[model samples]
Target: MEHRIRHLSTYSYDPAALRVALRLKLFPVDHEGQQVESWKVTVNDEEVSPLVFSDLGDREALWSSEDALDQLTITAEGIVSTRETNGIVRGMPGFAPPGIYIRETELTEPDEAIRALMGEATGDDTLSRLHALMGLIHERVKYLTGSTSARTTAADALKDGKGVCQDHAQLFIAAARTAEVPARYVTGYLQMEEETEELLETHAWAEAHVDGIGWVGFDPSHNLCPTERYVRLCSGLDAFGASPIRGNVLGETKESLEVSVAIGQSQQ
Candidate 1:
């Protein structure tokens, strides 16, 4: 499957004058099941600066404004071809050992509820158990937008019983780690066959390392493994680490952010 994607992020400053620095990981990963046809990143409507490669295999573009600016807009657009590999990530360069993913992050720290959820994943096979856990999470947490914020932790989302894809992925990672299965957070784009009022192009999912199969993606929010419709961007210990955009602002001024994303099947 092939997909065309467009993402626009705009930042507006209240004082209309502030210095800003940004790091972008908007580039898609080129791996065995995914191929990048064409991709580009632009800042303030111009081509991005030189890119620096990271150890996690993501290309980062750094941009800064020394002059007073009212707003900054970053746009990333590209076409990508993807294949369904049963959610298995293979033949990709490994950045960290599987055991490293078992370490807990602040957002994924497990509580009693998460520990109990991990215990409910009953199966002799690790793969099957993980699948069961995914189902459990889907049932436990209802998908409701605006029900949680970026600061929401796994335990908090579980207690609320409602959250978006990010919350689902975080809880899944926490539970998997509690079960001694190495898991990491993934950020990507999900192509929707038909646009809907509630549809979002950006998506989040969890990948757990199976003893025999390596890393496999599990989207508890959708209760399914990633398919060709998924375009993986990057992975990390948690959402904060895997965020597509990270930055800082100099000078004291209010900031407002707006993001728009579109992903659809490309015409041949």
Candidate 2:
């Protein structure tokens, strides 16, 4: 499958600020399942700053504003071709050992409920057990757009029984960890077949390391593995760790953000 992706992020900050700096991990990962045909990033209508690939294999763009600007805008546009790999991430450079992903993060900390769910879904085979866990989470958590916030943790989402994709990914990560599976959070874009608008948004999923099979993507929100429709961006212990953008304001000022993304199948 081929896709056209466009992402726009606008930040409005009080001019009282001295400088603003940000690190962007918005570039899609280059792996066996996906190929980048053309990609570009820009800020305030200008080409992006120098890009550096992180040790983890994610492309990083260092963007900074030195002037007292009222707003900053960043845009990323690209065309990518992807193939279904049964959710297995292969041909990608490995950064850390699988055991590293087993470490718990604050957002993915499992509670009694998560442990119970993991136990009930556990099976002899790791792959089957993971699939069961994903289904269990999908069934338990209702997808409500505004039911949770960015700061909401997996435990909180599980308790409330309502959340968005981030919550589902986090909850799945937590449960997988409790079951002794090494899982990480993934952020990316999903080309929805029903979407007809020019403005879309990013998506989140989870990846677990299966012995002998490597890392496999699982999307509890859809109760399935990522396929050709999925385009991976980055991965970390949780949402915050894998955020597409991370930045700091140099002065005391208020800031507001707006993001728009559009993804659709393209004629090759």
Predicted model with the maximum lDDT? 2
lDDT of 2 by residue, 72-181 (tens): 88898889899999999988765777888889989988999999989989677999999999999999999998899989999999999999999999999999998788
lDDT tens string, model 1, 210-265? 99899999999999999998889888889998898898888888889888888877
Candidate 2, residue 46: the lDDT equals: 78
- Local error of candidate 1 at 67, Å? 1.1
TM-score of each candidate structure, all chains considered together: 0.95, 0.95
What 10-residue stretch in candidate 1 is worst by lDDT? 192-201
lDDT of 2 at 244: 88
Clashes of 1: 0
List lDDT for all candidates, in order: 0.88, 0.88
- What stretches of model 1 exceed 4 Å from their correct place? 196-201
**On a 0 to 100 scale, what is the lDDT of residue 1 in model 1?**
91
Error in Å for residue 120 of model 2: 1.3
Q: How many clashing residue pairs appear in each of the predictions shown? A: 0, 1
State the displacement of the C-alpha of residue 37, model 1, in Å, after optimal TM-score superposition.
Answer: 0.7
